[model samples]
Target: MAATACGTGSGPGGRADGRTERVTSLTALDYYTDTTEHAHWGELLTGCGEKAGVAVEHRSVPAPSLVPTALRQASAGTLPDLLMLDNPDLQQFARSGVLAPLRAYGVRTDGFGAGILSAGTYRGEVYGLAPTVNTLALFYDKRALAEAGVPVPRTWDELRKAARATTRPGRYGLAVDADASFEATFQFLPFLWSNGGDERRLDDPRAVEALGLWTGLVRDGSVSRSVLTWNQADVHEQFLGGRAAMMVNGPWRIPALDAAEDLDWGVVPLPVPRAGDALVTPLGGEVWTVPRNDSEARRRKAAEVLACLNGPASMLALADWHHTVPSRPDVAGRY
Candidate 1:
């Protein structure tokens, strides 16, 4: 956890007798509100806290409320000693000057993938780190594909044909989170990036081509217009109910899909624009940070716990439990 070198010394108070007092407890907050998920995280934090010689008080809030709650706490000068933020929101909080730089606390910042490291960095300083991360993939119903005589797709042309072939009276060939929210953008990036479309230049021909593929599918009845209102969970529900033969989703859905005894499913990396083009998927995960607080001792203790959470053993355990990829390349290779 990197704390072995830092050493746990005096916490908040010093005695005239010269005996160092250790911090015995710390507070942590995150958005793992689902019962089982929350419990798993609670166990991990407790274990890490034990290694750091402290007890951790772990709490969770709804995902959408996390940022707002954190901001309010920061304003009140009461942010949790250890905090978790969605990767995309880390920059905003770091820029707000409420997160302490991880390096400053002696937390190891190397050995992570470049994209994930960038996600945690603000103004050239790394402020957060995630044990595991995830990205999108194409999940298809094996029975449906077999019935349609379509093989798993590897290119845009194959995907379009497969989708069209799999469409039936009660089921759309493909489903995706296409609601007017960031979920839609998250699902759309692979197509846009793989097609050589730049978000900075939506007017590019490649961007138009990417949009046309999605629109074309809906027009051809291979994708439902209702996708305009569906979020990721809704798309997963549609797939589970057999109303969609294939869906664009992430590995986090694997547990639910595995629980459907009658369903036979397969997943593959998202199809690219061409056979040789690289598929570019958006990175997704939550990062843990030590929020700036009044007590240096408390912050240091929190950093020790943070380091423990990001340690190799913890990363592998998290990746296995959550069906995610480890953030460190070496850990990911082993995973």
Candidate 2:
């Protein structure tokens, strides 16, 4: 996506005397609460803000608190000038009239995957864009799998057998986020989708089969009951601590996995129900948006910063740093 000033209208930095005015500062928010992740994003935002001729005030909240905080800010008429939302949550806020369409600020929306573009679009308008995106995959410990004499699984049957073979006293064969949160739903989607289960028809036999797979794993002692309370982060920690031989997680966990000196891990696309079945994973990432606010100038500046953040250089840098795929295909190709 490419964004540039759209018109000569007297907007931010525009003057009545046909001169230019500059917005000096802006506020931005997101859910990057980890110390390293937060600092990385802050640096990117600050750089983008400088390019937009503004200083940015960056803030972060815990993942679960981000939406509620944004809601409170929206209700109080104090939404941050630039807001970052998980793609799944974009529609709710867009429908609530809290986001401005990227088109209104001249953001070129071509060259993106249909799924991600749809994720950022609401009512046929683009409200946000992500620099990079991610999806779930099966991560396994090489040593554990080798010890169990099982190759990486490619289908449900193989996965089940491998899980059973790897099982022992203190370790689980697999781990997944199954808490009563979006993370659980996110983790389950690949199974549901790959099995031909539709969200609209949860009672379908295929959906039932998908759910059965999860329950069967728990009942057979391949997966732990503690999965009921685990989030993705917790699941990753379980894998890192050697309590889990395999995990269903996204690439965001790569940094931590690579940092563990004794760990030798490998990843594969999520297994499918059958050998030829397509594995469908949910799209995962955060989108940057210019929120509706009091000052058009501020909104414009925010848009500028948003544009900078989504530019090719920034996209590649973010993907390299975070182990995510660049959202734009051209950039991803280069990456």
Candidate 3:
């Protein structure tokens, strides 16, 4: 099994004075440039920081700028006391030894979903955990599909058929990001994983089949060629403008979707390759980490804030605020 490690220790954080250091403030870094997202995080960080007996100096950057910022911080030996990395980048950061292994700080990882754990693990140890995680889903205009007498699709065949039936004079039936970027890969993974396409074997016929499914949608005019240039935000805009009836997106778009002009949207699991096949979508979220610091007490205090931020109630609150599912399945029930 490709499982993330969950063990306990209290060894690493920072090397501080032998005496416990008093931390007045801790630096926190995240990529939550969206006004609502940034504010929500600020409120949560304040509450958690208070509980940890430290004030938080929170800073946010655009999502695209986060990795570069972290890289610069790492090189300068000035990584924030706390870091929030999109899951894919967590392991690499952890592997570089700049991140303090979360378990060492008495943080629990007992009930996070496998995918989230997988993304935050390096070698056999977990270095981070998210408060809320998201995954791709099939989002349809409920009214449009209902008006067209089409139900939600459950398999590749049904998805193709629904897309075909919904295609109209000014609108495409479906849309996705087909650009050559990680966003495209993110949007493609559900189809690939659902069809049993292993990332380790790109030569596998299942992988080709999954690719064919997406290309076939475009070839058949069910999807626009614009997908080649569009990203998820573009796709979301298209869906909101009624230029696409269905999209492969996630709940992170829900806040915007809710604010749109009277669009009734419904979400379902991404379509499977075949009926009865389990839907397997890529996990999307940011994981919190405590960086290696010079002060052990400060590092430990930062870990306290990290833990406080991910407590059950905090998880639910953030998940609700972000329109995402809580990282811990047990805590998700309350949201």
The TM-score of predicted model 1 comes to: 0.88
lDDT for model 3, please: 0.84
C-alpha TM-score for every candidate: 0.88, 0.92, 0.86
lDDT of 1 by residue, 1-335 (tens): 01112223335533346655457778888988766678778888878887787778888987668889999999999999899998989989999999999999899999999989999999999999999999999999999999999999989889899999999999999998888867788899999999999989999999999999899999999999999999787999999999999999988888789989989999999999888998888999989999998677788888989999998998998888779999999989998
Alpha-carbon error at 176 in model 2, in Å? Answer: 0.2
Candidate 2: what lDDT?
0.88
Instruction: Put down candidate 3 lDDT per residue, 1-335, tens digits, no spaces.
Output: 01111212223333334554456678889987777777788888888877766678888886668889999999999999999998888877887899998888788888887877777788988888888887888899988788778789989999999999899989999999998767788999888988999878878999999999999999999999999999888899999999999998878788889898789998988899999998888878888999996777777888888898878988888777768888877788777
lDDT of 2 by residue, 1-335 (tens): 11122222223565557656657777888888777778778878877876777777888888888899999999999998999999999999999998999989887788887888888999999999988999999999999999999999999999998888888988999999999988899999999999999988999999999999899999999999999999998999999999999999988888889999999999999899999998888889999999998667777878888998999989988888889998889889999
* Candidates' RMSD to native: 4.6, 4.6, 6.2
Query: Once superposed on the true structure, which residue ranges of model 1 sit more than 4 Å away at CA?
Result: 1-22
Off by over 4 Å in 2: 1-22
Alpha-carbon lDDT, every model: 0.88, 0.88, 0.84
Output the lDDT of residue 258, model 1. Answer: 90
Kindly provide the TM-score of model 2 when superposed on the true structure, using C-alpha atoms: 0.92
Reference-based lDDT, residue 8, model 2: 26
Candidate 3, which ten residues in sequence have the lowest lDDT sum?
1-10
Clashes of each: 0, 1, 0
